[model samples]
Target: LQLNVFCQTKPTIEASTNIQFSCIQIHYDGLDKQMTAARLNLLNNYWDVVHDFSADESPVANYTLLYEEKAVQLQSAAVFQNSSVTFERSKSTVLSTGNLLSENINQVAILFCQVDNESIVDDPKEPLLMILDIYRQLNVSFVKTVQTPVDAATMRNFVNPRWKGSSKSKAVMAIFIWNCTDNEQNFFNKAISSNNWVGKVNLKVGSDAMDVIDEVYKIIDSNRS
Candidate 1:
């Protein structure tokens, strides 16, 4: 048994790279380079070497590692040092959003889906309103309205593909404004269960917009795999 490479060409020749193993063949266009994280993922490796285990201090939960002398008293932004106000106002959130939107269109993006007004709950108007406020404030490229729940197949058409050979490209993420309706919930659950999409996305449901965003951010932070 031996690793196989069916074709080889100069690096400047950006054509497809072909690989075969006797009965099996895989075709990959060599136009762009794969990112380090994705390359590791294909090798069945973890994104964070410190993780790959079930622990409370998983990559996302644990603070980013920094090296300094106890000289590493472990200093973070004062805001992050406190528990009550850690997320009350986060510079990281603002910075990440700005960077994502400002980058090339081929890269990162946010898909926002607004649930039908009629489907909205009469209660929890405050939380809904907050979400609306953030929506309005965002430098939106596009807003899609879903009158009813949709299957994952329908969403595939709009979602930009993420995992390509291009090192520069990234996954398309989405913010779904849920009305806490059973039908919508069921639709998403079914779609997730099917899981046939090419580009991967982490869809999390929460009571408020903030909660879901927080959860999504965690996934995004650790999604190097």
Candidate 2:
């Protein structure tokens, strides 16, 4: 003969919000006796056992089983210190709504922006000034700048082939400015050729300059990849 066992639960308070699990046990008497019943009896009190059974010289018996409820819930806090802010062309400003000021949390602030030579050609120094303005407005101590090159060599080496056709000249000039620095060796190393002299500007400010540059490089590399 075949025996089947099943278990279920009655509805409880809706606030319980916990998951419930159940199981059932069946006992066969044809090939078992008191010795088997003793072992089964020992297991009856286990927390995991919803139900258990024993047969008194009978061929079969069935029992329903159940288990304690278990549940999982997710919770989070809306603290700005744990969040990040980003700036893109589509947005008018780098500041995110309600995130401009800090109450008591000290944070590592970063600023990143891209500018083309054509956009600031009238005043070649405007790009740097714009960056400075943003730094002052945000009270940020660090700033990192990335220059995209337009020259054929730079285009072939760094700039994507797709962008080369549209603004090849601008990309090369931007790269030239980006690589320039007050140090003669650093400036020479980045120059297009030994004969083509490029001017360098001392833009490094405070101890945070290096950190800002490193962060900006990471963002640029990530975008390129």
Candidate 3:
């Protein structure tokens, strides 16, 4: 007596799991019903993939064979206050939540907190790459405050050196600390609105870090093309 077995195509994507097996009848003719009945033996027995299921044993199999599989979804975010400081977001602030080495990220935001011109030159590369995120993925950077907004020529020169990667590639947003009393902060607002901002980038000004971050979330969560 011979038994025929067949298997169907299995999933290959990293997300797929679980395989189902079914019993298929092949012999329906005058193959003696008693003979088929005898094939059914003990209810439980040791089973092996290769012997029982005739599964593919080749090393270079096309489908993924999971011995033990587990799935867990993880949320991640990186934030930097300054070169050395890192501010934690409040749970109320973050609905969910890296040098974020992926500068080719979909969006980029340059944040202007209070700053003196001295540290701008020596700012670590890590902080520039790292950023705060509770919603969508984007890059955030900090810049030195100037007393007055930069002109078109200055905007081209001033924004690039501090910004890594292609300036025009990713969507850029500039967020500055805007207070009527602070001259530098006032200028920071105007700097972001230069021709550089119009259609290519987003500009937001707020009184404090939390306020700026809140606007950041709005921009990131928005669906404006």
Candidate 4:
């Protein structure tokens, strides 16, 4: 099974304004067909898709088993913080919308699906990893900067492909906590110094989502010269 996600990019998303997501699921392995259930999910520190499932399909697989929907909403402004402060967030009913149309979409959102046949891929691992892959391929990027400096070091070791090679033109910005340790603070500085990408910015942990977006715009503007 393969799943792809496409979103309606917005110039501005308000606290109660709606943002849209379109999820497409394809079955190549043939182990599953006809989605038994589907959902719009939010990504967190553990990327827990199971417990975090929201916007469930009405009547289940009613969409011809394609796993597509257009009614996902922004619900409230607070959910947007989940992406920036990964480790600090607590599990709760942070995401829920029965396709009735509310303002739920924020900086981070993901999709998940379950097929009628449970013979293969019962967990959310595939979809979660798929989103990560999408993030890696993007030319403009944003990451919460990691809760611990050690995690940052681990991420550094993992490396990003766009940050390498001769044509390092992609823009990436890291948002860190205000009280982040010195090592955590230095991670982006070191990464920016070592990477050849167009430019990189480090945002304080408490910075607004718009702040990160603005910094990314600045990097883009600087590179335009």
Candidate 5:
């Protein structure tokens, strides 16, 4: 039997996150019904993919497969303070797209939370607040933060590098931090509005992050339904 399983169409996942298997496909080569049943039993005994239900006359197959796959840990932090960031629902997108990196090359919706504040260059804690606030707004439980270092020989190369690899992708609420200018913020606004695939939380220096809670909630709520 050939078993192919997919948790999310775009399986990009952060560390310490849980994924529900949404699709599973099994292929058998010239299987007899009796042989297939026995094979399934053997597979179940080894893999435990199916729950035992022999006590009942007929067995029901469970659709969802709970897969807890943790990504490689890079960085982590905890959010103790509650989030008070508000979102501009009028400008929020219903969805965002990312390269699924799957066999079928499908595009999937991705959630992005960006904290474009110059303050983070000096005080990293400020960006953490922004990240935690956005996650709280999205109702995603706080997990340790993680980042992949750009290993380049030179500063220029590190700043502008090309990628040639595939990593697991998932439909998830993402977080980002940028020190943006007024023109850049305008561009970000326009970009997110134009592309329904991404929702952004813009944070400025010294602004009350909690002020955006209602706005953020509205955007997340709209997408939830």
Candidate 6:
């Protein structure tokens, strides 16, 4: 028997600021009835009678081997059927409960299954890989927040080396702000449109730190292009 499982968040919005997500499970049973019956007895004494007839080891037994084999086959079928039914029913409940917290935050979440990279000879570039590469180049100390929204003031404070450390200890930080309101979006658009952001790569002081930032922007550009 082989089992495959996967989980991931979905991309759908709800209310003013909510999103939805899912998870999936797959299984494959490859053993024949005779093989399965034999294994069952090997693993436990409870199936001794079934295995004895299936393996033709007890020819002198009063009961017919065909009848005993049929009974054991039915039992195995019933076990697999019951397990599959329970699993499908439980899946819905699990997904609902797991994402309940997100509901309050106006978001829906799910676990998704994807193909393993090892299984494929040729794999395309993805945003996740880009993010991972950028993460490796970045200094750990500079990571103040992760996957959270921030205001303009917070952004300014994060970028200012003087506020957090001395010139020698300063590190370049990247902040990801999300779940912004319409007003916030407008503000960002206006700021960028008016060229208010410096948008300059400052490598004079923190050359190594700025290199990481440059790599991150390059990834962003590649993703967009």
Q: In angstroms, how far off is 146's CA in candidate 5?
A: 2.2
- Badly placed stretches (over 4 Å) of model 3 are 1-170, 174-182, 193-195, 199-201, 207-225
Residue pairs with backbone overlap in model 1:
69-72
Worst 10 residues of 4 by lDDT: 88-97
Please list the residue runs of candidate 4 whose C-alpha ends up more than 4 Å from where it truly belongs after superposition.
1-179, 196-202, 208-225
lDDT per residue as tens, model 1, 1-225: 121111211011112122112111222233112322222111111111232233433433322221110111224657444343222222111111111122332222233332223313122232223333433444332211111233243233333222222322223334433243456445544443443331333343333333434444554455433
List the lowest-lDDT window of 10 residues for candidate 3.
91-100
Report lDDT (Cα) of residue 118, candidate 3: 33
Listed in order, each prediction's TM-score against the native is 0.20, 0.20, 0.17, 0.22, 0.19, 0.16
- Best of the candidates, TM-score: 4
Which is the better candidate, 2 or 5, if ranked by lDDT?
2
- Candidate lDDT values, in order: 0.28, 0.29, 0.27, 0.27, 0.28, 0.25
Which candidate has the top score in lDDT?
2
What TM-score does model 3 achieve against the real structure? 0.17
Cα displacement (angstroms), candidate 4, residue 196, comes to: 4.2
Q: Kindly report the root-mean-square deviation of model 2 from the true structure over all alpha carbons.
A: 29.1
Candidate 1 segments exceeding 4 Å error? 1-169, 193-195, 206-225
- Model with the higher lDDT, candidate 4 or 5: 5
Give the higher-lDDT candidate: 1 or 2: 2
lDDT value for model 2: 0.29
lDDT-better candidate, 2 vs 6? 2
Q: How many steric overlaps are in each model, in order?
A: 1, 6, 0, 9, 21, 15
Q: Candidate 3's C-alpha lDDT?
A: 0.27
